[model samples]
Target: MTHFKSQVFLILNELPSGECIGYGELAKQAGFPGYARQVGHLMKNLPKDSKLPWHRVVNSQRKISFAENTDAYWQQRHKLESEGWIIVGNKLTLNEFDQKEER
Candidate 1:
């Protein structure tokens, strides 16, 4: 894997179950502060059977990035909610689950 991808994976691996970070924050933690899109790309390409908690990453708005009603969208929401996250409509209140990014 490339260094950048490796960094992204490392960050994903470190996220505690039920916790989440934004795409931009993941990029920043991966040493690419302005590369949020790259982080999203890396996430999209993760292997289908991969154990990484890709669902734990959201948009900067603290919302699921996937389109509602799609399988991916529901899957992410289900995984997160199963882990104690509160989803109101398409947005998750990050603070309720202690998953909000520290400022």
Candidate 2:
């Protein structure tokens, strides 16, 4: 995989349970400022069996990037809930559980 995508997944895997990093934030953390779209691309292309905590990544508004009521969004919410995250009003408050460890 490309270095940036690898870095993105590494950062994701480091997040503590119940925490999250938004797409924009992750892109910036991966050293590509203002590259939220790139982060989305990376997530879309990640292998299905990869161990990355892909569900912990969301949009800047703290909402699941996928459309509400869709299978993808429900799955995302389910995965986050499985990890102990709370979803309220389309927002997942994860600041308290953030783990900014480097890859």
Candidate 3:
């Protein structure tokens, strides 16, 4: 895998549960600003059975990118909700579900 993609996966794999992020935020965290589309592309191409937390990612607008009512859309929604996320008016803010770590 390319270095950038590898970095993205590493960051993604370590994402804390109950935390959501945006595509742009994911790209920026991976040290590639303005590469939100690339992050989205990676998400789309992930293996069907991949264990990556792709459901934790949303759009820059704090909204799910999937078409409303589509299977993909519902699937993403279900996953997020199952993780204790409450989609308010179809919007989910990054870090909305974050909890303070017990350092």
Candidate 4:
């Protein structure tokens, strides 16, 4: 794994269940500001069966990155919802449900 990928994974694991971090925020925290797409690329390479908290990351708009009907997106949604997150319309607002202590 790349340094940035490991950093992003750490950030995701730190999130409390039911909460999420935006791709932009993750990239910044991983020392790659303005590189959310790079963050996404990192996520895309995560081992499918890995125990890392992949569901804890999302787009800055607080929306899941993939379509709902697709297995990947549905699995993400299911995992988040199981942890008490609610998907409202096309957005998954972490502002109201984040588990991390605000920095």
Worst 10 residues of 3 by lDDT: 94-103
- lDDT per prediction? 0.89, 0.81, 0.85, 0.80
Best by TM-score: 1
Pairwise TM-score winner, candidates 3 and 4? 3
- Name the better of 1 and 2 by TM-score: 1
Q: Which candidate is the best by lDDT?
A: 1
Question: How many Å off is the CA of 87 in candidate 3?
Answer: 1.2
What are the per-residue Cα lDDT tens digits for candidate 4 across 5-101? 7788888778777668888998998788998998888788888788888888889888999987789898888888788777886577544344454
- lDDT (10s digit) by residue, model 1, range 9-47: 998998998788999999999898999999998888888
> Cα miss at 62, model 2 (Å)?
0.9
Better of 2 and 3 by TM-score: 3
Off by over 4 Å in 3: 93-103
Q: Let me know the TM-score candidate 2 reaches against the reference structure.
A: 0.80
lDDT of 2 by residue, 5-68 (tens): 7788888889877777888999999888898999998888778887877888888788888878
Quote each prediction's TM-score. Answer: 0.90, 0.80, 0.86, 0.82
